[model samples]
Target: TLYAVGDWGQGKGKTWTRAGGVKLAKNGNAYTGTTTMTKGQAITARLIKVDANGKTTWDEIGDVKATADKTKTVDLKWTNAVEDTVDITINAAADLKTGETLYAVGDWGQGKGKTWTRAGGVKLARYGNAYTGTTKVGKGNAITFRLIKVDANGKTTWDSAKDRKSKADKTKALGVSWTSGKVNEDGTIPDDSAISISGKGVADGKLSIQKGNLAELYVIGTQDATPSDAVWWSDGAAVAVSGTGTVYGVQTGTAKVNVKVGNQTATITITITIK
Candidate 1:
């Protein structure tokens, strides 16, 4: 359940009134409520969610168009406002253009993750090939993010590397080098997948296919790390992943596949679950 309230004006002229009850919708992760207000009130409203343990969270409602004696359905997604500080750095040498800006899109459930938007990206300051910025977050929250660069014209490109996860808090600067590929004659770099050395075991321990099914696993690699040679094999299945990094689920149980890329080899534990 959610508690709703409206606040208007301030000081002596301030007015506060109860909005109404808000219940969880059928789809879940959403709330619905009826708020009656005087037309053109210009009032600000908020919701306080009361959880099972009686712990309550506050969320402010965004702009909503309300009519006199009419119903309005406002959709909201919870976001912890960014208040923490952290530095981000990226290294790209394929000429990322002068106006292109690199941002770190993150918050894999660490701290309040609503800091970045697809329209504007992360709020990082660009310095040459690196970016520096910070957002205030709850203390000791683990933050994981991926790097994306946006050109002035709004064109965007993501780094080929996986999420840069950190155990320590953001007090320590975040850094990751670019895995950009060669530039084409049109002054455009290849896509992130093109730069990746397929089957770098990106999904190692992640997955491929279910039982009696075979699917190809993609490797997420950087340009600097060209793990060209890969040998795939399963522990018990007669079929194994060849140079294609494709695997088959021969048994209904779990199977472990080994991918040896250059000197480094990663073991992918696959659960052959067929629905």
Candidate 2:
């Protein structure tokens, strides 16, 4: 019998029977039969021999590799199954520009005998806000990555200042959001400073609230010795705020609130989850 595992259904790992008793091939070896897979989707499977009384005798573990076509076939065969663990990894893709390229360097690559250039760097494919790719690395390996953009005239731009860092493991899915747009020509990173509301109930940069719930928007930066005039605005019709920065949630949806303190302006995102 073959069993599928790892995010097959929902929420982390899940197991499902992929095949019953394996079919006997012409060479007498048992095969689990072909399993169809998509281009970017990955799946890990384990083969188990079951006795008549419903007990597993032997097991062999393996993973399916994605192909270039829209679909791929996977079949598992083992003459002598053994008990062991096999780690399967599917690298994530990022949403980025068309002309730009993503690269990863650190203990996972450089320390492992790879350079930090376009030829030696680990390249990631653009997948709509994510750059996805696959690499084999031991657990707990530290990694850092950067982006390079080359123009039509052969000029190149590098976003080396804001390299993202993470550890290599199943628990850590590496991802970074280019919320402030791409890197500039001079290599200076863009500022992503914005106003945020923090208090009793808030998570993931979003302020969750019910209808008629009162929330406060806090200024994130240090104020000057002299006070400046502050103005506040809300994009959603259901959201309203007083002059003192107290916000009231009137309906369910997302509300983008903007605050201007003298020459500086910042926006806060609020989500009205319960009406």
Candidate 3:
């Protein structure tokens, strides 16, 4: 409906007018009409949308100038914008290793579409079994994002969903996934890049052990449930992974192995003292 909003001599008030009504679309889907309540004066146009059952869906107002049969287009702007944020969680795929990196990309955070600055760096922190990120969108708009993994060798792995190339861009968020591996609930370490020189270091990214008989290098990872997938990696032949991180310490005296259980990196350098 149209209303004349001006000094009507009665303390400047607005009243109903029969000059015109907002016209609906041809198929009765949208509003597109004009009014001539008061020529050369400002007209206050109020449009109300209702459902088939007469339930009010939307109600907005717009001010337009009507001058001597001139139909000025009314651009209605809704003041009640959506102000809720969305929480997106990714239960990262398995096969993740310690010392590697997992990042979120494609516009999930303030990074424009990235969750971090570099591919080898992780910004979205992982908790329990999920990597959580956040974003805000309009009522009918969808959010987009994808997962990225940077391995020990600096190789990247994108989200392996739907051709493994498309970012998750949708309005619905409801799903589950598996973890990189499994963590010992009793693992003594508290953060990434940590190793256990027979349970000595916690959150420290480095440690050492002895030769032959000191053959075991156990990594009791973070206090949180992290994947113990860091390979039994080492430098040259200073030590060999006996399918269970067994050290030889016979042929070589120095070795360094890089691994991680979360975002940080841990390097285990063994300074073997020959027996």
For each of the candidates, the C-alpha root-mean-square deviation to the true structure, in angstroms, is 19.0, 18.0, 27.0
**TM-score result, candidate 2:** 0.32
**Candidate 2 clashing pairs?**
92-132, 93-130, 93-131, 93-132, 94-129, 94-130, 94-131, 95-128, 95-129, 95-130
Worst 10 residues of 1 by lDDT: 195-204
TM-score of 1: 0.29
Taking all chains together, each candidate's TM-score versus the true structure is 0.29, 0.32, 0.26
- For candidate 1, the C-alpha RMSD (Å) to the true structure equals 19.0
Q: Write the per-residue lDDT of candidate 3 for residues 1-275, one digit (tens) a residue.
A: 32222232222354533233444442123233333444445444444454667564334334333233332233343442222442333334334688666665554333344443353233444543344333343333333445566788988776655311112222222222232232221222233444333222212444445554334344444332112343455765665443234444545466676445445555567665655
Candidate 3 Cα deviation (angstroms), residue 22 = 33
How well is each residue in 2-28 modelled by candidate 2, as lDDT tens digits?
A: 333333222244444424323322322
Segments in model 3 whose C-alpha atoms lie over 4 Å from true places: 1-81, 93-95, 107-122, 137-139, 163-275
Please list the C-alpha lDDT of all candidates, in the order they appear: 0.48, 0.46, 0.40
Error of 1 at 130 (Å): 2.9
- In model 1, which runs have C-alpha deviations exceeding 4 angstroms? 1-94, 108-116, 119-121, 168-170, 180-275
